[model samples]
Target: MAQRGGPAPFPDNPFQDPAAVQPRPGPELDAYNPFESSAPPYQVPSAAPPPLPAAGMPPPQAAAQPPRKASPTEPRNYGSYGTQVPGREKAARPPQGGPRRRREPQGLAFPPQASAAAATAELLKRQEELNRKAEELDRRERELQNAALGGTATRLNNWPPLPSFCPVKPCFYQDIPVEIPADFQKTVSTMYYLWMASTIALFLNFLSSLAWFCVEPSSGSGFGLSILWALLYTPCSFVCWYRPMYKAFRSDSSFNFFVFFFVFFAQNVMYVLQAIGIPNWGFSGWILSLIALRKNTAVAVMMILVSLCFTAVAVLGIIMLKRIHSLYRRTGASFQKAQEEFAAGVFSNQAVRTAAANAAAGAATNAFRAP
Candidate 1:
């Protein structure tokens, strides 16, 4: 009776265990009666018999019955969406604080591949880039071939401008095109020409000083000093700053770069002083040139022209200094690297090692008396 009236029961199947099937909904749940006006709350009568009256003792008259309250007949809807059955409710939820279970996906899904045209387009684009790279490589290859066959390969160093008959052989081999990288070649050539210009300027200053002596015999001392300056600075200038700069750019040597910076800065300072033309100085500088203005127009003009040459060289020196410094910075050379190079070179020299050993031996002897 309790198992067959309300709704369909779950069936016996392999997907569910038959022994574990839940009890079916019963007839009592389907008997909810919310429409009757006078009906008392329906209560199932008990199976046990009612109490009997004792010997001539009648049961006390039942108390007057209370009126039955009527319930509303129309049902109101809650927000639940699924099939709702009476007299059944879920159990309370478990408490907090446990590892969450991993949810497995209900189904496997594979996204579709891209179109064939898209893949072909990507492949073509990559092929084009490869072709472009090949073209660039071929161009560079031709440049290398030409350079090997006809360019710097055939050139030789003819610096010092010395003749074959001279007893002193050429001291240095300098071919800028061959030794220097292409990026620095133009700058190196400019510096080389500037050196020649400076040489010519110094010689002109001597000739101007000689002209001064001819105009004023008492000023012969400057002329003599001018000759000395010409002969001394001509070769010294070549050896000092210029050669260091050449070597610096040639090998990208930090030590040589530092050497060039130190010496060339001093050389620029000398150029400035020479341009000023202090009295009794070998240079026909601004002072001597201006002084000649009162004596002879021709001498003053020649001296001023020489001073201008010196000034030009000074200006060019400053510009080249900045240029070389920029190049040096780009080469990633630092003073610490220069110091390391210097220390290595010093220790590697056989003469320096010999001298150091001898000095150490003498020091140790003096420290510990003769043994």
Candidate 2:
């Protein structure tokens, strides 16, 4: 069997074993292997030594050190990397420094001269506006003055230096009459009546005194005393009745008329006191009559009687004045309506036109300079 198996099929190939198939052990496994070299551990080459100095000169000095490399974990910048081309690798440049240049503004440009011209135009426009205002004010003042002089009822004329008529219509009197309203006229009439009544009462009181003097001649009264009383009553009566009436007639101002009436009404009361022979009554009568009455009683009584009659006439006059005032009041209202109509007709349109013109001018000026 040995001889037959001896032809032992060719020795089993050791190469077919898994463990023997591995690389053979050699210097490759040694700690130091000069002959076995790998791709050279990826080492970065050291910088080439500086060029040797000329023949006998000292070695070249080193340049200042560049900044150290960043760690692998740090951000890597490819900004300096160049694209791969045939054979070129352009060196990267350091970032530039210093202040950035400013870009010039574009679009519509106004020269310095244009700006100055615009300013001058604005100043001129302002001056024109002020001048216009001044003229307007002056015109208004003139209008007011003319109105006052011609009376409030006067129509306003747009053209200057032309005479204007009162806008109020003519009343009972053909001449321009004070244009008081109906209500105001009634008030004036009432005031006049009151004042006249006071005067009449004073006059009647004087008549009573005269009758008394006639009955008793030895009553120690005199003409001088009566005359003195009459004088005092006359002026007070004027203040009480006439002055207020006159004021109403002249101005037709309700406020002024009322003021005069109240003041005079007070004075009338004082006259009544004096007429009744109250002691220390009037300044002139008491002082002057006291001295004169010492001689003649009859004459004094006569004078007193005449004053009484005068007072009665004043009463009648009050009634008459009231009637006349009532008539005037009705006429005054008509006048006022006419005056208002005339004013509207004359000035309203002119004022509107002036305002419109000014506004249009302003709008035109703004449009010319639209942004």
Candidate 3:
């Protein structure tokens, strides 16, 4: 019997014999059989007689039965649980998210959609309003500019503002407010002329750079960059120096005066660098003009003009820097006041306080919600 294959695995299944296991039927097994007869209704054993109504009262009639529901095979629908009955309408439901009505402003009806002609008229009216606003803004701005220049609209109403020395018509710098002292006006005005001279020099250099691109194709990209730089730098240079200087004079602020002096000092250094005509500087255009001096007659003429302008800027920049230094000396700037201004600007800023308050309120709200 134990000859091979671990005694033949005990006959592969010892329980295959019918008598080895018997499945006893539970009470529910009979209930699941569809063909089985239905069981008799449950009956209770009577222990005593039921109570009777009083002798004087009549016996009660049987209660009426409710109608039967339709069978699953029937096609008729009784409707869902909340559906209205045949004889009566259902009441409307209140809106789920509470009150749905919006109050109109002042009980006025909304404006009607405009016809084509009405739309055109409305557009014209709006444009007129905008034009009026624009004119008011321009008048107010001009008045402010005049006030800053130490003149009044009333005084200048009879005559135009002071004329500028620039050759261009409608010179924008002519109306700009400069609040410098009468003694400093000549130097300041010359400084402005220097800015114009610098712009002219840059334009001349821009032209020369285009010329140089033909001579040396390697630097062709510099031509466009130079043109762009000249266009952008001219207006920016005026604002950067002139506005700061004006503020310094107008407020006589020690902090502002120091700022102007420091900034313009750096600017003077830049002027010297530009006058040197360094190759591949952002002002490479000026450098090319110098290189083309001997080869091209027209370029030589342009170079000579730009060279004179650059020299003038360098000389005038040095003079203006010195004048600004002298003005700073007279401004009564003190170290203590500068420190006070810095402290106040940092600590008393309204935006910083508002942000801090909002952060604290958010933290408090989160804390209240945590538990």
Instruction: Write the candidate numbers in order of decreasing TM-score.
Output: 1, 3, 2
Global lDDT of model 3? 0.67
- Per-residue lDDT of 1-371 in model 2, one digit per residue for the tens? 34764566344786786675786677757677555444333458589966667998877767796555555445766644443564576765556885566776887678999999999999999999999999977765665576568754554323123334745432222111123344556555555555555455445445544544454455335423554556676566555445545555555534334444465545545544443454233222333234335645654544455445444544544455456446446545344554665566455798877987899999999999998
Clashing pairs in 3: none
Q: Give candidate 1 regions above 4 Å deviation.
A: 1-158, 361-371
* Local accuracy of candidate 1 as per-residue lDDT tens digits, 190-219: 998888888999899888988888888988
Any runs in candidate 3 off by more than 4 Å, and if so which?
Answer: 1-183, 282-290, 345-371
What is the lDDT for 7 in model 2? 64
Q: Which candidate ranks first by lDDT, i.e. highest? A: 1
lDDT of 3 by residue, 257-319 (tens): 666677777777767766666665545325545676757767556655666677778788888
Query: Alpha carbon lDDT of residue 100, candidate 3?
Result: 73
Q: How far is candidate 1 from the true structure (C-alpha RMSD, Å)?
A: 27.8
Q: Worst 10-residue stretch by lDDT in candidate 2? A: 170-179
